[model samples]
Target: MLYYFSLCNILLLYLILISLTFLMLGFYFIMNGIIYFIEYELFMLNGSQVIMTLLFDWMSLIFMGFVLFISSLIIYYSSEYMSGDKYLDRFIILVLMFIFSMMFMIISPNLISILLGWDGLGLVSYCLVIYYQNIKSFNAGMITALSNRVGDSMLLMSIAWMFSYGSWNYFMYIDFFSFNFDVKIIGLLIVISAMTKSAQIPFSPWLPAAMAAPTPVSSLVHSSTLVTAGVYLLIRFNPLYLDSSLSLFMLFISLITMFMSGFCANYEFDLKKIIALSTLSQLGLMMSILSFGYIYLAYFHLLTHALFKALLFMCSGVVIHSFKDCQDIRYLGNLYIQMPLTCICFTISSLCLCGMPFLSGFYSKDLILELYSSCYINMFSYFLYYFSTGLSVSYSIRLIYYLIISDFSFYCYHSIYDEGWIMLKGMFIMVIVSIFGGSMLMWLLFPTPYLVIIPFYLKLMVLLICLFGGWLGYMINKFNLYDIMINLNYNNLCSYFGFMWFMPYITVKISYIYLLMGLKLNKSGDYGWFEMLGGQGLFYMLNDFSLKNQNIQNNIFNLFYIFISFWFILLFLM
Candidate 1:
């Protein structure tokens, strides 16, 4: 047993080393301006070929490197976090499978191979999400799996749709199919598929619900791997969306998702759920940026967000574990005094998330803001972007107040430990990256920086929003204004925000209501009408005839004589 546990750690360490080597190699290639693309046939079907293809430009390499790095850290951290569990080996295996699936998707340019990786991710994530074997975990896993299956089915449809072109490798014909109507159909399907995977708007509940998984899984899958797969797909399929109506549609949906999740996060009480909501919000930001044809900027933000968000989750895991699995922020307070290192990491991550200057998020977020300011967006888009920005700060401040500044509100007596060195060490790696990754990536990824001019007020827009949100969050959380508002005939409004702007209600109406109606129809029509008119009805009528003919069969000899007389009479009449 001990050997198995040690083996898990060893495997993670080996993967980390390999990933670091590849990361450095990728950087070398980038610095020297190299691109590697390869393809080979795996099989032949009806004179067509099934091929394995790889495309490694700066994008895939950097993205692959980041995915591997984060997965390794998560696996390393899980070693200690999951030490006493009976199924530790199983957990490690799942994590490794999830990582492999992500790597496969990253390297593949063939739509077939991408679907292979895509389905693999969805299946493995469901397993990981349901690892706890509780009702909540089971339901969450079902929701997560079913939600992603929507994307999987859409991807399959795209592959079949592409059959008309006689090839499943989208990269080969990306330029040729730019303005084709079929290409638009495929692009629309891809956009919806991405929406499902990224948990945009109507598909968003599964993301937060998936926090029922273990915290390590949350840190890994929710923060880095599963959620980002959609954005990565869009990065690969960027050509399909240029000047397309679907891009504008996606932009609006992404904006709504961004604002909705940010608003939901402020009302969220569960620590892991809050982090999950933040992930959803960041995904929205990525998708929104992608819709604008700034795929590189979106990718840049995706990478940086993965760094700090994973660290943030790891910090949340430490706090939850330390508090004996209590994740309610209302019960969590004075963590800065109790768990100093974890607190420090969490604070830094929160600051980065809020786009504080010079952090990893600062660089990417600053670029996004600059680009938004420079774009020819209408007033609605402008409001949504800046409003979402303020909401991000609002939630960050609200969380900090509840988790760090408030008095410790729990009744249980306990000693807070700065142990869990393994977890903290994993977090430290990301912390260093989160502190400087933005500046480094900005320098590396952008050869020529974007030039955008803005007025003084526009330049300080994010700052002003943050200030306003911080003040509002402080007043609501710290000074009891939320309590006063809740008591004074605003409970219904509070519930709406608390329930994520009625998204859950809307989802139930659309999803569950339809599901129930289908079941009812099946019961009444297929089972009721069809059963009566088809199988059971036929069986009952045949059985009644058989019973009526029982005497005739028993008197076969007499019936034979009667048949002879009838035949004689017929012959005479003829």
Candidate 2:
């Protein structure tokens, strides 16, 4: 036990040291406007070089810093969370592998290298998701793996397409060949790949389903690493596709994803799933902003969201741990009475999610909304964006009410307490960053402030929507038997909204069809058709033929014996 504890501390220290180093380097690079690229040529084929490249831009370095920092804190928290688990060491190794995979993905400019990291993330995430070894975890892991495989396939196709360009280092030719047909195809493929990784629109269900993983993995994966890989990829490829029609398509898809996820989060009851849905909504916001060609703003929000979201998950983990693994929010009430520190951190993170004034989310979310308003988008998109923002606040307020404001809903006899010091230590660090990480990142990422010249009504719209949304959330929790009956009348509608508009069902059905096909193929190819036509069928045919020949020989022997007996009788009579 002590060895495991020491192992966690050592890992935590190393990750933190590396994170600080990366962060300092990132700051220096940003300050000096320096971009360094290091390349190692592995070999050449047909004059097309295959080189492993690492990019040391402010973006990659800072993102890496954030990833490692969050990873370190999560690891420390997990030391306490998974203290009793027998496979704690295995868990730690998997997490370290995940961190390394993320680092590789963050720094690599080569498509081939990116795929290696990308595939590693998908594979490791699958392993982590099924860590609990239950049916649900297994299902969740399968869904996570298969869904990500789509993105992997897309990325592989993009790599194959890029082979025509003589080098897979996309950074070298993306801008130069921005208007080329092959480049456009590669861009489209990359967009699809990013969509799958980021869980956009049709691909959104996996994010919430991935909640089957442990809370610490949840904090790390959902916050800054796995899900954000798609947005990061798009940000890297922003120069190539920002001017194309793909950006417009991405805009619509991202807004709908934002609206859908925010709406679903309100209807969700599971604590982790709610947080996961919120992550989905935030990812949509990032993708939407990226689609609008504001790359830095998207990146800024990504960093800030990572801080608060991780804190949110950490606090939820504490609550769930104290509740003896009860994740249904209805059973969790008055947590503030038992876990005051955790409740405080949870409330702060929830408010940050709501874009409350001066919070981390406010800086980035406000800027994104303001910049979105300033854009020349359609009114439909405008409505979706603001409405989605309101829904975010709605769900957040609803969660806070269920967890902290309401009376205790658990059993009469319960022993819920905030006892994990190491977990609290981790949450404490995140809380500080969740409060101030936004403004700090904002100033550093964008040295020049963006100018927005929107009307007063437009600016005031956000405040009004937030207030209205909060009121709606409070009302939602105040439902009586009458409201329940009224909702029952709209059961299908409620289920549709609650189930992420049946996106999971769609994914399941698609997978089910493939599984069914595979079953049929296995039966026909291996058992039915092949069995009849191959060795088994030949053996049966040969056995029957030999049996017939033996029967014929037996009949011939019987006839000869009859003749010999008849001849012997005749000879004796003579």
Task: Score each candidate by Cα lDDT.
Answer: 0.86, 0.91
Q: lDDT by residue for model 1 over 407-444, one digit each (tens)?
A: 99887688887789989999998899999989998988
Each prediction's TM-score against the native?
0.93, 0.92
RMSD of each: 2.7, 4.6
- Best candidate, lDDT-wise? 2
Cα TM-score of candidate 1: 0.93
Candidate 2 on 295-352: residue-level lDDT in tens? 9889888899999999999999999898889999989888887889999999999999
Which whole-number lDDT from 0 to 100 does residue 14 have in model 1?
A: 82
Off by over 4 Å in 2: 43-50, 480-488, 530-574
Which pairs of residues collide in model 1? none
